[model samples]
Target: MPVEPSLRVAMTVEQCWQPAPGGSGTYIRELLRAYAELDDLSVTGISAWHRGSPPEDGPLPVPVRRVPLPRALLYRSWQQARLPRTGGADVVHASTWAVPGRRAPLVATVHDLAFRHDPQHFTPNGVAFFERGLAIVRDEAAAVVVPSSATAADCVAAGIEPERVHVVLHGVRAGAADPAGVATFRARHGLVRPYVLWAGTREPRKNLPRLVAGFSAAVRAGADLDLVLVGPDGWGDERDRLAGVSADRVRVLGRLPATDLSAAYAGAHVFCYPSVREGFGMPVSEAMAHGVPVVTSRGTSMEEVSDGAAVLVDPMDEDDIGRGIVEAIWPGAHPALAAASRARAAQLSWSRAAAQTVAVLREAAG
Candidate 1:
């Protein structure tokens, strides 16, 4: 066997310390762990000075070295002053667009151009910050990596050259769910049998209001499954919407530990994630990996992640979403849909994502 030449990688991991640590945090952790299993590269995590390790949810996969400032100051410095250059590696990978000074060839992963798609999704300052980051990516980055063709199209529309853009789909790390743990999870939450599952932050972009409405419609149409919601509370006042919903049937089980979450996926009758948009819908792929038939948005990245194994609907239409959910759980659908979901999910793996990322980083360095 031949040995693969390796390069040192300085990859930003600041998202790991964030309080919410959404999908981007997952990206940093999973990619580094995948990198550790490979001989193609050696990665050193980069973050601002912080008191302790990342939250207790998981272990750190790589050693980290810090910059001189706290998070806010460091982010400001990167966007405007471009200080404390990233020079200790063969190439620097800005895990998100909050890039460091370009002391080495810089390759940046842009999760999505959500801010650009609709400025209202972000605060005024957030939009400005993202604009600054995108400008830097356009002018300074040796390569720009995106998670989906949908996001790649958005990047080009925002004026990044097509040739510099690379689409690298995210990996699925979801494992088989435990039956005993799943039963316990159901009992603990007072969940009824054959429930439809929805996971992800409760934000405007997640389109929860419409999901709730659609779910109500599904129930009205005589779909037997109850609806179960999971994940951390994001910004939104869904009270008014949920008030009209059948409170007795809907269960809002907030965040769970990873084991229980996988159990939730394992036990779902249908996984419904009709968010308005996504760069890559990690949860949808995760649900599919668990062999649950999915109902997701028709044209977004979630549809791509589902790989034709899911039922697609227009996210903007509560009625269409309702129809899709009903279809997914319609009689005589589970066996084939579940089989396809597993097959499509089998195609995604972290080792593959790690190798593709290393190739891009090396291309930037070369």
Candidate 2:
């Protein structure tokens, strides 16, 4: 096969200079890792600096250019008086609505329209910022990339041209299952087997209050299962949802390293993520990649990502969520469900997403 010509691509990775409190950071880093493998792409990463140089995450396969401007100043300037430095590349890609001035063809990734759809999940300032940023994206970007069909539809609803929207499903990496490590993680966190795992930030959009209510109901129904919540404290007080639940059965682990988190996924009897809304539920796919049976919400991208393998329940109904959890974790459940979950995950790959993203960037460049 003849090799495709290399495309000059400049990506704004200011979000990656620090640890990502959410999935976007992971998306940026993983996409970059896959992009680095392409011989037909020359990539440049751009970030802003305020006081000191940008922090490095080991050695990247590509070069990075740090603009000597604070984040606030850069965003303010980009919105009004200044332009982001893109090093004159053919295509300038913003990971999440951080578009630069007219330097190159723009490819913007709109993670979600949560700011508009669910204002309660964000601060007023945050909603305003996204409302303004998305306007720029819709008005100026040559191509728009979304993680799921749901977000693609959102783009069209927001008045972006349908032809300009592309849905590139995110990939999942299933690491080798470590039995010993799984045992260690359980012992370290005092977690028992047959626990339902809930990963992601504790936030309103995640619908943790309902999840906790459902878990409490399941326990009340004599289902002997523990509920483990992972990730950092987000906007809401999650404990308010766990009002009457027994302390011994519910574990709140703030955060664990990737290796341990993978082990937790592999060890769990079932993974539960009944989110109210999502562009793409990374935890659901990640759990599926580990051959774990999943219970997620219906009528959202979580259902799309699960692809008929997971048990879908109404996210708002605590009783329905509770029943779904009981059925999913029942003894001698269909082994094929676990296999199917992994199979669904196998179909989504970072290499494929990277190649498609590069193609979109090339098209926009032309």
Candidate 3:
């Protein structure tokens, strides 16, 4: 009798190592961490290009191979001329846009459809590249994975067959709050008492300008709360969005280390993410996981992921956002909301996401 061969899977994780902005890095890192726990599959982490050696300081669950080439070089070589370095796996998984040619089936994760829905949010060149990349995923990939049902809908709307599209919500871990770390973070950032937190890249889709306006409006409405923006600089000038807000009341505690970030989430009086759109609002779920009351945009992925645990507000309306913030931080205004948020967060976990993803891969590979 012939023995069954192992299922070799190649996963593109350059984003996990690159110093790129946004949470796609976290999504890939966390998914890989969870995948490491599974035994039935043999996974090879692939980074086709890197500025330096991939960070291997942390003990990874699987072996990683860096292709020793830059992204542009690889794109020109594989996309235009040669075969990609997919490690001869039974399946190839790309976390985002870099879907390479391979003998095995390709699985692509579509994080969001913001590029299509709001082309103005991106440069014309950027929009063109995304449209081309997504078209490739739809036309060529064996299966497409999305972080939210909203994103899945977007894919179908864009002409992807429903059967080929899978909705896999992002899993979040709610770790224990470190009081000492939280204190250090607050002191280091000089965060005043009772601050509202907003964490995301400072991009237009995040609606930072409106968020700032809402925070200011809340302040005028008798809420003495500072707004803590935790993320890296992205796309545009931060000062433009923060034009009218008093500098002292809003602190941009640019991206914190993971532990410190978790502590920031735990320490906040409330977490508000009024992004105009999202595939899955990871920060909202992260805040909910930490028992932080949340206020997020309505009719978007935030509403889908939060599942009524968060106060929904029109992201475009500063007054509505301001009201939601006021209601969130007011001592006795929404105790049950936070409790519900914690409960809802507990239901979402990376282990589950990994299991679902593995199952999807198995079906796609077969």
Best by lDDT: 1
Q: Any residue pairs clashing in model 1, and if so which?
A: none
**After superposing candidate 1, which stretches have Cα over 4 Å from the reference?**
1-4
Model 2, 1-366: lDDT tens digits are 997788988887777655443777778778889987888889987777744433434444567776778777777777665375465689989887566665788899998997778898888877877887898898889999999999999989999999999999999887666899899989998886479999998888899888988988888888888898888777666646655587888888877777878888998888999999999999999999999999999999999999899999999999999998887877666476788798999998998989888889999999
lDDT by residue (tens digit), candidate 1, 1-366:
987678888999988888788899988888888887887788888999977898835557788888879999999999998887888798999988789986789999999988877788667888898899999999998899899999999999989899989999898978657889889888888887689999987777888888888988988898877788898887647534564367767888888788888999998999999888899999999998999999999989988888789999999999999999888887788778888899999998877888888889999988
Candidate 1 local accuracy as lDDT? Answer: 0.86
Q: What is the C-alpha lDDT of each candidate?
A: 0.86, 0.84, 0.83
* Winner on TM-score (2 vs 3): 2
- Using TM-score, give the best candidate's number: 1
Could you tell me every candidate's TM-score relative to the true structure? 0.96, 0.95, 0.94
Cα deviation of 109, candidate 2, in Å: 0.8
RMSD of each: 1.5, 1.9, 2.4
- TM-score between candidate 2 and the true structure: 0.95
List the candidates ranked by lDDT, beginning with the highest.
1, 2, 3
